[model samples]
Target chain A: MRTALRLLGGQRFLVAPLCLLGAVIVFAASAPEFLTLGNVSNVGAQMWVLALLAVGQMFAIVTRGFDISVGAVAALSSTIAAHAVNALGPAGLLAGPLTGLLCGTLTGFLIGFLRLQPIVATLGMMIGVRGLALLVTGDGQVVPLHDADLASWLAFDPAFGLPPADWGAIGCILLAGALLGRAVLGRRLVMLGSNPDAAHLVGIDTARTQLRAYQLCGGFAGLAGVLVLLRAGTGLPTDGAGMELQSIAAALIGGTALSGGVARVFPVVLGAAFIQAVLTGLDLQGVSPFIAQIVVGLVIVAAGFLEFALRRFQGFAFHRRSWT
Target chain B: MTALALPLPVRSAWRRWRPGAAAWTTLGVFLLFAVLVPRFASSGNLVNVLRVAAILCVAACGQAIVLVLGGIEFSFGSSAALASVVGVLAVPWLGPAGGLAAGGAVVIAIGALNGALIAGFGLPPFVVTLGMLMAAAGAAASLVGGQPIDAPPSAAFAWPAAGSVATIPVPILLGAAAVTVLHALLSRSRLGRLWYLAGANPVAARLSGIAVGRVTFLGYLVAGAFCAVTAVVLTSRVGSGQPNLAPNLPFESIAACAIGGIPLAGGEGRAHQVVCGVLVIAMMNNAVVLLNFPIAAQQLVMAVVIIGAVLLQNAGSLPVMLRRALTRRPNA
Candidate 1:
């Protein structure tokens, strides 16, 4: 048991996977249908939007900052995509991400160049973007897609055992993983986050790194918006009001250090998946959705406690080993 | 000796003039609205604005305390919503006054919980408060099956919101009292000094024999008490329990504090700043409505003002690169 504890505590990214496994076990035992193919596919289909958002949030959090504006930006992108699709056909899908990139750039400018606090900058962006979305949709009305057939096909029709939208999400996640693991910008972001003073001393352009982080975050939010648009078959201006909190919770639970610098794309995705599973499992059990929300909230706090415990145990174990 | 003496008077004069940017902004916004928006200067409309500002002021005062501790409280909005729900539910059994007390206790309890988690565990304030926010909101929602619960209308129930003492609304009186008390606590009390010290530098404060954790815990508790007052008044006014009551309370309060020149980095704020910030926001909202703009326009304007206000406030501290970028000539 001691060795097991040490092994588990030794790995930085293992917490999310462990939590996911525990959730799967408990949910599978309580709700027999949780592990079934149909429900699994349902969760698979539903999780991409959140997954995309969580991954984007990870970028900001890894940089020792976070973007709360992603949800609002996604809504704005969704509305923009709806209008673009109506006017320009299938080519308009690209507009969603482009719009997101623009919003992200503005947010990045505010945080990086203007030196505004991340929370303040993102909060301002959130309000402005929500307003922009409302303006686009005219009084927060949902904008129905003209190409319903295409949307449904992309959203629902399975190719390679997954819908096109899910495939797209997977592709984006892979790209994000590659970017974080391989790219020079990613290294700069991590270095900056770990120690801004040292990064500056090392000649890294800190402002530009922050700018790129927020840009990547916003771009991911835009991709999530595209997914939302495809899934809902409409542009919803007010759809993603609470998603920012969920993404933050997911990123945190996925072992993305709130203190910044440490993170992984796959673990964060598992974290999102765990949340989605809980939500889905509760729904299947006829439990109130609000109860699920409470559980999620508890899980978030529990994740914090778990992190704390692991840190303490690891320290103790190291001390004992060195003394012996 | 003359130069030093001259500088003393100049510094004092600057201090006297320094209600700071937020105060000036309030005056400017009020005057602009009075001139531009028809009927905005009318006494009745002005009273309405004050009435709205009163509730926000009380909440923002609590928010200011938390900000002064270098902590953020996102759960205020949801906790207020939960309080209203719990308050209304208890009214049938506990009566109006008793129900209100129960609701206030619930908020205080939540504040204590947040305080314990943050101070005891060394968890981030953002994480703990956010978690509590979700939990409290869920509790409120689940309690009523996601619907509003009406409290039986009574004179006693409405007294806190509607009743007047000396021809002044209770909310306005309460708002004034909150500001005055906050001012006293921040400037005159020993606990207030400790809060400031802890917020500014926790490690140094600890080394200096201050109980930093206890101070932080109390700051959150005091903030919660302030939010409770606002919740009670709001519930009294609505005469119902709402799951979605004041969802923007946290955001609006933070904005108000920021606009008032209370830096989020903490350890400095004043009661007058909270009042001035609340007044500016209230006036802007009132003016937007009076001007017949779309709801979207109101949000857009608010966003612009919030960002612009912060930007303007921090202009003096802008980086050399940014200052150069701003001043660089097109030809050059």
Candidate 2:
């Protein structure tokens, strides 16, 4: 069992799956409706946005970075896209993606080229982008949307029994698997995260690789923004309010190292699903919402402990090496 | 030899202070705001800015120590909220002095717990403190049953925040006192030096026989105490325990420290960084209000400043700077 856990990339990676399984068992026993296919699809649909954000976050984490700004990116993109769609109709399809790309590029430049600390840099961007979002929306009111054909197609249109957004998330997950497991850029990013100095010495342009990682993160954030905006049927600036913490927690629980380098796409998606299940299960069980916050926080901390323990077991003396 | 020797004092002063890019930018912004903005240069407004900056300085000062030791605390704002709750609730039971003391102890204990988890278990400070931020915020919310706890208005209990000491506002005086004590701790105390060394190179510090774990643990304890001080001032000023008090403070405090030129990666920061950074933010916030710009603008500007300050402050040395200088080619 120990060797199996190690082979699956340590006990840390197993946490999200185990949590998901535990929630299923517990919730199925308590809430009879939880086992219903109808509720299962409902939970899956709800988890789509978080899963997308986690996938974006995974890219940054793989390169020894974190993008707290993704939430803001989502907010800004949705708001901006909402405005554009209101004015330009079908042409506004490009708005959300473009806005996300722009925000992602900016965050990329700060961390990759400018060498700013990822957390602080992205944090500043988070606040700044949110401010810009608020400024655009004016008076913090949610921008009401008129039902457009494009919006309906993307948001409400069922794609063989699921919304297009859910399909998008699944596609992104597959894309992430390909990117991290096979693509050269993804491989370079893992290398850079493993040891930036070594990667640089080996003729990799670390800055560009890191920049690409953030750009992808930002793009994914943008996609998430568009999907969420569609579902809500309006551009809510505060929509992504707690998402930054949620995505970070999901990434951590998914087994992405806070210290960076390891990135597995499927586990991250499962982690997001696991968190949603826990929250959904709690809600069904009539638990307080605040408990969800506490649980997310504790899970992240636990992930940290588990990661360190696993690393120690693997004979990686972190303090003696990189930290010092 | 004479000419080189002539610049020695000047060089030494710069090295000793090593005020990062943020300090210069603060001065530039001060001058700019004073010139372009109406009534910005007025004495009354400047004092008001300083007064506001004082509260931020309390938390930022504590955070600087953590940053210097290569850790970050996201819990200060939430901890302050919790402290405010504790202080206001305890005031009726324990009176003013005892209430503040009780509140102070809770905040300090929160910090110590964070320290023990981090230092003892080798857990990442980011995750540990992020968790604490969540738990603390939740606890504060749950304590008042999601309502703000109001303290009965009393002059004696509230004097530490509302009243002045020798013409200075109590909050301002308290802030100044905190800064002074922290400055002394960082510059004059052995523990401060140990913190710097540990932050710079923990393994080296451990090999050198420094108790890196204990020092780190204590550093967090001090940070917690500072958070309590800020909480007391906030609670007393408002005459209430506000669970929502200072929600944005953690980021703002960090931004202030960054503006003061504290490297986010840690190892080198000081009390002055907190002061300078807070002043800049205070001034900028004042500018937004005075200019009739939306509050959102202030956040946007702070965000830009954080990125700009970090970029300029940590861009490596002279030769590297010259290499990237606009008019030059890489191999030229």
Alpha-carbon local distance difference test for all models: 0.88, 0.82
User: Which parts of model 2 are misplaced by more than 4 Å?
Assistant: A1-7, A148-153, A317-324, B1-22, B314-332
The C-alpha local distance difference test score for the whole of candidate 1 amounts to 0.88
Residue pairs in candidate 1 whose N, alpha carbon or C atoms collide under 3 angstroms: none
Worst 10 residues of 2 chain B by lDDT: B323-332
Write out the backbone clash pairs for model 2.
none
For model 2, report the TM-score of its A chain. Answer: 0.92
> Which candidate number has the best DockQ?
2
For every model shown, the clashing-pair count is: 0, 0
TM (chain A) per model: 0.94, 0.92
User: Per-residue lDDT tens digits of candidate 2, residues A1-324?
Assistant: 878876777666787888789879989999999989988877888898899899899998878788888888998888887888888885674698788888888888777666677867898899899899989988578987786566667767787988776787688779878988898888898898888888888878777778788889888888788887888878878778778778888888898876668878878988899889888888878877677666767777777787678778878745422321
Q: How close is candidate 2 to the true structure, as a TM-score?
A: 0.92
lDDT of 2 at A136: 95
- Candidate 1 deviant stretches above 4 angstroms: A1-10, A316-324, B1-14, B317-332
